[model samples]
Target: MKLLLITAIEEFEKDVINILKNSRLKAFSYQSVKGFKNDKNEMKNWFGKDDIAVDSLLFTVFSEYNCVDSIYKNINEFNSMQQTVPHIHIVTINLEDENFR
Candidate 1:
């Protein structure tokens, strides 16, 4: 088993969900989050603020290795076709053991 963590701006929520479904990932969890960036570009700042906050989502999936690989490949394809920033980000961690009681 492995733990998959996927993050992207809230605007891409539907796209993310579609990717997960297409990958045949049966179960997962997600939550809304605030993404922070300390950009020096004044024009990019909101209301002259130095920091920017973006509405984002974090997806957590526990799955087998093969499923993780499929999800990664699908996300890469989705990002490559985009013509903008804030692309989806995904990572995985190996699960050495688990306990359920």
Candidate 2:
């Protein structure tokens, strides 16, 4: 079992979801977040009144390590095909076990 965390820009939220869907990922979670990066990492045009920067975060877990490969491939493909700064960040955590009631 494994856990996949995807933190991406708001604009790519839909793309991420679509990619997950295409990969047959059925269970996942998401939320809208408001935060700011460092001065150098800050967005060039993310200011919206008072210069606040916000973004969306998506998280999902897979029962198999192999299942994650497809999503990673899709994300890589998207990243390679697009010309954008601040690419999405993906974190993978290996789970020892999971209990579901």
Q: Largest lDDT belongs to which candidate?
A: 1
Candidate 1 has an lDDT of: 0.81
TM-score of each: 0.84, 0.76
Off by over 4 Å in 2: 39-52
lDDT of 2 by residue, 22-84 (tens): 877657787877646556445542322234476656556564666689888888888787776
- Give the range where candidate 1 is weakest over 10 consecutive residues by summed lDDT: 42-51
Tens digit per residue, CA lDDT, model 1, 1-100: 8899998888899999999988888799999988776765633422223466778899999887778778989899998998776788888898899762
lDDT of 1 at 80: 91
- The best candidate by TM-score is 1
Total clashes in model 1, counting residue pairs 3 or more apart in sequence or in different chains: 0
Error of 1 at 7 (Å): 0.3
CA RMSD per model (angstroms): 4.6, 4.0
